[model samples]
Target: MSNSGWTSIAETNIGTVRKVNEDDFLDLPEAQLWCVADGMGGHAKGDVASQLITKTLSDLASNAPEELSVDSICDCIKQTNYTLIELSNQHNSIVGSTVVALFFTAEHAHLIWAGDSRIYRLRSNTLERVTRDHSQVEDMIDAGLISPEEAETHPKANVITRAVGAAVELDLDVKTLPLEDGDQFLLCSDGLNKVMNDLELEHALKTMDTKTISNRLIEIALNRKARDNVTVIVVRNEKQIEEALHETLPLDDTLPLHYSNKS
Candidate 1:
C-alpha cells in the first residue's frame, strides 16, 4: 500500500486538422486513468469504434468491483473486449481499438495494454518504456532483422499484431511497479511515441504539469506529422508522509446524539 498525497489532471485534444477525436479519459477519486484508441478498418466507423472502447472502459472503471486486484482489472478488460465485439457485430463493421490504461494507488501503479499504445515511467529525469509493443516491427527488432533506429522508420511499424476487437479473446499485457515520490507515468497511443523519442518526451514531461504535458505531447506528435489519433495521461506522485499522535480526538458535535454518544 502507498501513503502518498498526489494531484493529477488529464486532457485530450483532436489534432489540428483531424475531423474526429477518438481519445478519452477516466478520472476517478481512487484512480486516474486515460486511454487512446486509434480505430482501424477504415471509413468513419473507425472513430466510432475507438469511442466505443473508451466509453466502455470508462463505464467499467466507474462500476468496478470493491476489491482492487489483478484479476478484477483483467476481467474489466475482458468485458470491454466483449462489448466491442458485440458492437462490431451489431454495426456490421470490422472495427477495433488500441488500448492503454493506467491504474495507480498509493503504493503501486498497474499498467494494462494492448496493441501499440505505450506506457512510460519517468524517474530521476530518466524515462523508461514499461510496456512492450505488440507489433510486427517490434518482433523484427527483437529477432535482429532491424536495429532500434531502423525499426522506428520501418514501413510496417504501424502494423500492430494484436488489439481489442480483433478476435473473440484478447490477451492483455499487465505490469506492476512500485510507487515513488517525484515519479511520473505516461500512457499514450502510438501517435505520440511514433513521432517523439524518449529524450524529447522526457523534456516535454519535465516542463509541464499533467494537463500541459498531455497537450504538449500531442502537439509534438502533430508537429512531426503523425497521422494517427493521439492520447496521453500524465501522473506525477508528490508523495507526502505525515504522522500524528492523539490521546482523545473530539467528536463532531453536528452528528446525531446517538452516534456522537458512541464516540
Candidate 2:
C-alpha cells in the first residue's frame, strides 16, 4: 500500500445464536464514508430499521460533493435519526439502531457514533479506541462506581443509554484527528468486543491485511459463540502509487455493501 490513498473492507455475520442478522453497513470508498448500524427491534423489523439507515446514507453519499466534509455527514445523520424516530413512533414499537461512522478527507479523519458500536484506530502498531459507548455500564465506569473489568460483565452492560431511535433527539459523539499515512480504522458492533479482547484485536490488526483483519475478527468472535451479530469494517490510509483505483469488498447475507458512488 502506498501513502496517499485509502483501502477498505467490510463484513458482518449473524453469529452463533441469532437467526436473523439485523446489522447493516455502508462501504463507499469513493465518498470516504463508511458506517455500521446494529439493529435492536426484534426479528420482524430489525433488519428494516437498519436497512433504512443504510439507504439514507447511500443517498447522502450519492449526492455528496466531490470533496466530503464532516458537517455534511453530521447533518445527514441527524436527519436520518429524525426519520427513524418517526418510523418507530408510527409502528408503536421500539425500533432503534446503533451507528458508528467514519468520514475521511485528505486532511482529516472524523468519527461519529451513537450507542455501543465503536470506532478504533491502529497507529504505529498500537491500537486505541476513538469512541465511547453510550451505555449504562459505561456511565457507571465513568462515574467511578464500577471498574472497567467489572462493567464488562455487569448485568447492565447491554443497557445502552443512547441510540439513533432511542429518543426523538440524539447528540452524536464526534472526534476529529489529523490524517496520517499508515493509519488504520476499525468500526465494529458490540459482538466483536464481547469476545476478542484488546490484545487479540491488536495482534490481528498489526499482522493482517485490511480484508483479512475484518474476516479474522469475525472468525474469532464466532469461535467464541458470539450471541449477537458481529460486523467489522477496516479502512487503511496510505499514499497512492499504482493502485489509485478503488476496490470492491465482499459481504455476508446480513451485511449488504451499499455504494452509490463507486471509485
Candidate 3:
C-alpha cells in the first residue's frame, strides 16, 4: 500500500483505423497518479483536448504535495474542465474528453471519471470493472429496458451522457478502494473495452508484468479492428511500506514521460 512500492506504466495508440490518435494518458509513479483521457471531437481537436488534460495532470504531479489528496486532484480536474470549456467556445465546436484518473494514498486509492472511459481492478485472478459508462445504453440497462448483452452492441453505445467541455457544468463519479499487495488496476479508453470482454482481460492480466499486460491488451484491441483510439494505464502495488522516500526525481517533459503514445 505504500507509495514507494508502487509502479505504473501507460501507452496510447491510434488503433488500426484512425488517422489521428485522440487518446492520451498520464503515468506518475512518483506521485502514484495515473489517468486515461479519450478525446471526442473532430480528429486534431480531439487530440488537443486530450493532450491538455494529460498535460494538466502532469503539472499536478510535479507540484503535488508529498502526499496526494482527493480534494486537490478534484480541484485540478474542475479547473481543467473550465479551461477545456473555454477552448471549445473559442473554436465554436464540441471539443471534449472522457477522463478516468486514479490517485493513491498509502493504504487506499481514489478514482474519478466522466464519460465512458473505465477503471478496472484485477485481484486474486479476477477482473472487475470499477467505473460505469455514462452512456445511453448504460441508462437503458439501468432502467431494465435492455440486457447487458444487448447494451454492448446497442446503436447508441457510443453516445456518452457526460464529458468534460461538452457542457459548462461537468459531473464526475468518485470511488475509493482499500489497497492490498498485488492489487493491479487498469484504466483505459472505451476503445479497449469495446473489443475485449472481462473474461479476456482477466486472462491477459493473470500472470504478466504491467508492460506485457498493457501491450497484450492493445494488441488484442487492434486485432479486433478497434474503431477508436486505444489507451491503457497499469498500476501495481507490489508491497506495503517498503522503504523511506527518496529524492524527488526531476521529470523531463521534452523526453518521454512515464507514458508512451503511438500515432
Q: Estimate each model's TM-score.
A: 0.80, 0.86, 0.87
RMSD to true structure for each model, in Å: 14.2, 8.2, 8.5
Residue pairs with backbone overlap in model 3: none
Per-residue lDDT of 98-163 in model 1, one digit per residue for the tens? 777777655777788888878888877788999999999999999989998888777997788887
Q: Give the TM-score (vs. native) of candidate 3.
A: 0.87
lDDT minimum window of 10 residues, candidate 1: 254-263
Candidate 2 residue runs with Cα over 4 Å from true position: 1-3, 41-44, 238-263
lDDT of 3 by residue, 174-230 (tens): 999997766778899989988777776665555455545577678767866888889
Better of 1 and 3 by TM-score: 3
Q: What is the TM-score of candidate 2? A: 0.86
Candidate number achieving the greatest TM-score relative to the actual structure: 3
> What's the ranking of the predictions by TM-score, best on top?
3, 2, 1
**What is residue 123's positional error in candidate 2, in angstroms?**
0.9
State the C-alpha lDDT per candidate: 0.67, 0.77, 0.78
Error of 1 at 166 (Å): 0.3
Better of 1 and 3 by lDDT: 3
Off by over 4 Å in 1: 1-3, 41-44, 90-92, 239-263
Q: 1 or 2: which has the higher TM-score?
A: 2
